[model samples]
Target: MTARGLIFAAPASGTGKTLVTAGLARHLRRRGWRVATAKAGPDFIDPTFHALAAGKPCRNLDVWGMRRATLAGLIGELEAHADFVLCEGVMGLFDGTGPGAEAGSTAELALMTGWPVVLVVDARGQGASVAALLKGFAGHRPSVPLAAVIFNRVSGNRHAALLADATARHLPSLVCLGSLPADPGLALPSRHLGLVPASENRDAEAVIEHCAARIGTSVDVERLLRVALGSTLSAAGKAAPLAPLGERIAVARDEAFCFAYPTLLEGWRSQGAEVTFFSPLANEPPGADADAVYLPGGYPELWPDRLASAQVFMTGIRRAASEGAAIYGECGGYMVLGEALIVGEGQICPMAGLLPLVTSFAERRLCLGYRRATLRVDTNLGAAG
Candidate 1:
């Protein structure tokens, strides 16, 4: 039926949307409420944290990558599971691929799914101007509604009071749910890709709990819940599976290869396919009986030495390739499939050399964008477009 949900959004990146969303998920879950989580875009890393916080597998609701039917199917599935669904939005509330485009923005998601947004503002250096910003965002798109505002990185009670009072004076209809004070310990560690995936964060659980405690004390969880539950979203329905890759697919999964989406794998299973996991980082290869192999993106450059020296793992991959097992890779996995990978300080590490491709991490370049590729020939992904 109507699954109460909220999309955690911000004015820009680094506005503490992930932290607030995760903390609120944990806090609400601990208070005996079933919580489901999702990420607004195609982010593999943030969904892991969302899963850890909500104590369930998190799904990705991408506006750009996913078809409307696919999104509807996922929303149906989410509605089937929990009382509340907290989706953390990408980058900024209105930011997307191009100027005036809403394809991948949080605003687009809110407009599509009717999920009210809980905007988290970085209130470090502003006061009454915060009201103007909120008013602009709230009025920017008539179709999308801003449910509440949570001020993050507030200097102190004095700063929080100023922000709250100013917003109340200007946009009185908007609710100030909470204000998180500046805390160094609350910040998560980051690297070239982003925050270290939740699996590698040793203190991840403790960090979630600490954030939850803070959120529980500071945020108006009950009021926010009311706002979410007030929405009249339709019930989730049955979904058909996507095009099948193979009957038995081998998947790479580990700290070094942990970027695969849960929904994709779940879709594979729904199509009556068997999926097995092997860790190249652990020197394990794909199962001998696998019909196809999939390698998702991750930070393989960080573990060059270990990946290079995994003789058993590398040998098995070569054997599988020789045996005509269809293999595909994306980004990091593509790097591993190449002849060599150049990591830090010009240290070139030997890879499987399966493909005549060369990738260098040492010589970094920015290739950021939404990519569209047409099939050159008929392949597992389907016929040429």
Candidate 2:
């Protein structure tokens, strides 16, 4: 969409780009703009927040973990179906490693996407020296267009004007869209992983609404849009999300099984597989009497009673498994396929009974990390040794 483009960034982490991007997306949506939001790294939580703001599924545009071709395809594919693309860059403009031994970074994604940068500078605890920071950021990178600046956490009008004037010389013709003060009232809650999981927050809707209102009122949208629309068009290529599954598979998809990746589903489609989706918690049997069933991760523990009452779904699952339909699950899905899932209320709930396993979530310790796993035997995910 030639309409506009935006990449919200900062000198480093904690400068409020996530909030700014969320707010801007909300504001634009309020202005009747069809906003397409994306994150420039392998973050699950940020994209969740972006989705909340943009009112659409926000996808990740990681250059680091994905094949070059896959990355291009993801950017290009998501660029469709929106009036504008608002990409939120990862930590500071240049904070990332490459895939395996590859050298591509977030900086590379910006160049590849043909989108300009909107620097979000935290003006807190700084004065005229903000100029030096801008100079270093501008000079440290080449080929990345520094479109404009947004001074975040400014103390007051006089403080903002001074910071703007101080940095104006280094960023010739650069417009300070507006300054955001350090608002104690607008901060999002954090978790060990970062901002609290998007699924667990009640204030998320209000947070986005408030931030959007602030950004819409403060930032110069016209200037930002001009810079975004000025970017040269590039071909992002076609990359599918799902991996290749066999001929046909029945995928459990609903509130209980919603953590499946878009890429994985898309990849299955590419492999000429018929991936039918259905709900297990809603008492709906999977679509099609397929050769296999995939149950991905989600909050299955929260609705144990409903899932237990879903006899139709459980029976269908058992029948599918009995017919030699390969059954597989990950995390929560893995827990659900077990014989019983113990709830936090000390209640045991019946599951698909595919396996004689039981799971409990009363003592949850976050299992967070990147994985480097290889298969040892043939499973539904792929060919094993």
Candidate 3:
């Protein structure tokens, strides 16, 4: 099934792309359209907000992290399930891994899927200059398909009109969907890892609803839909990215371990693996019948006390390890499997102790990038080099 979709992108970060994308998704969903949402890159945070707004799981389409067939297969899955798919861009529209590289950028996704981009421009500190910004992006990569523009954070009606007039004069061919006026109420709370996950936010539904109402009234929904290009992707043969850990895999889920990729799990299921989930936050452990356990990354550092007190969960994890179950953890999950976790001000908390490691969050440092590694021995991930 071919689905009409568009990528909600921006000239740069903080241009309100996430909020606008969520708002528009909710807006379309409220109007009785089946909306499927996705995030452009390897971001775990924004997709949660998108899922909340769309009332379905939001998948990530990473050009770098995923294979071409996997990306095509995901888009095909979304298309079959929805009337419209809204994808929120990462960082900036053209920003990717390295200097002047478009490998993993939203533009690459647009080119791959043949979905047009609705560029979200922050109109807070500009008048006619908004036109120049539009011109630059529209002409930046001609093949990327910049179809429309949304002026976000406009100060007033007069400011909106100025943006409209400027766009009309300079880039008359470019569709200006409309402007979202600056409203403090439309803002979502943020933490060190970007916007707080929707699961942790009690007001997530309320926030989505508020955004829907505001954006529905402000943005030109009909015009936006009219400009949305049908996805050029076709369903690819189902291929798991990696072999399943075991016949039955117990996955750790909840606030502390919520960074598992949907595609990875789905891929495992496609390969005839039985997957189940348990919440460590609720003192739950992996299923007894499972032969493998996966602990994904999340905000475990923030819930040190709760995790330390999860006696049952810790015991179950230890039992799994003793039973020779294939156990794997990454990032926060790795922290949880350690002997001790050092929270703020040197507060030491006991952990599962599956690994002889001690982790600390006393002074956080941002360590972001890509890495390539070769295994020296047999591990849960793969065999030795």
Candidate 4:
């Protein structure tokens, strides 16, 4: 298929790639272009912002959690839906799990999908040195081609001209799309997990509008659109979402349990499974007829007391577990399934007590990585390995 796509990558995180990508999505959508947006890592927050900006359901293109076929199928779904697809890269373009590990990096996705990457550089302090950085990024991996460069947090036109002229002199092959000015107000507010969830942000639409207005004035939308449309990936027909865990699946979705992957939910529907949702924070419970319940990861520690006293929700979960309904938890959800949770010093809250696990958030230790495991027994997910 001749569907075009572009990857917005940066030298590092916090370099304004998300803002630029969101802004560009809105700008293009306003011009009557059907834009498909995707995030290039295991992030759920950015995609929400992307969806708000593009007026479409944003999807994640994670390299670590998905197989090549799965990624290809998701891209194909986008190709079938929208004329142009724009993706925001994670962390640094090449920074990933290991020194050449291709599982969870933007560079790997670029190579896998053959999508051109536009380097989003933070140009707050340096001038000519910006060219040096772009040169390194362009040459660091010969397989990953750099289509263009857009400088973020630029001081003024003089600074942008310096970056442009230097890039023209040193790396004439690289295109300089332009630069965004330094605007502290443009930064999105954040909680523990990065930007606050878009659903909770009262000024979310205003934020998107601000970014779109500024980006429309700062960047060359026409040239950027042409470049994105030129880099097309061959289509792989959409694959069905993973099979449903049960005949009727009940999911907990709230500020405390909102990290579920949209692809997984869509997959369940594609397989003709019925899916339902409830909010634990709102004292809601799973449907009485649900055969399975899924609690995804989120900030359970933030409201231990509220969750502990959620009698209706807690009782429904226990009742479901007693009825032999399949129950699964991930990360914070896993913590909530335990006997008790240590929220702070001298404070503990009783939990569902479904599992022999106790979680302590007071200590504040971080565990972050990709996991590989084989089920030792038959479970609702699938047969044992």
- Residue range 1-385, candidate 3, lDDT tens digits: 3578999999898888998888889898888899999999988989988988998889999888878887887888888889999999988899988887988999999999899999999888899988888888888888989988999899999999999999999998899899988988778788978888888888888877888898878888898999987788745533346788988999999988999987789778988999999999999989888899999999898999999999999999999989989899988998999999998999999999989999977866656655567999987678998
In order of listing, the candidates' clash counts read: 1, 9, 0, 1
Candidate with the larger TM-score of 3 and 4: 4
User: What TM value does model 3 have?
Assistant: 0.93
Which ranges of candidate 1 are over 4 A from the true structure?
Answer: 229-238
lDDT of 3: 0.88
TM-score-wise, the better of 2 and 4 is 4
TM-score of each: 0.95, 0.74, 0.93, 0.96
| Order by lDDT, highest first | 3, 4, 1, 2
Task: Evaluate all candidate structures by whole-model CA lDDT and list the values in order.
Answer: 0.86, 0.76, 0.88, 0.86
Instruction: Judge candidate 3 at residue 140 and give its lDDT.
Output: 86
What is the C-alpha local distance difference test score of candidate 4? 0.86
lDDT agreement of model 2 with the native: 0.76
Which model, 2 or 3, shows the larger lDDT?
3
TM-score of 1: 0.95
Candidate 1 per-residue lDDT, tens place, 1-385, comes to 4578899999998888898999999998998888899999888888888899998899888889877767887887787778888999999999987777878888888888888898999998999999989999989886788878999998999998999999899988888887988887678888877788889899888888989998887778778888785224334334545665688999999877888888888889988999999999999989999888888899888888999999998998888889988888888898899999997789989999999987887787865567789999998887988
Off-target runs (Cα >4 Å) in candidate 3 are: 235-241, 378-385
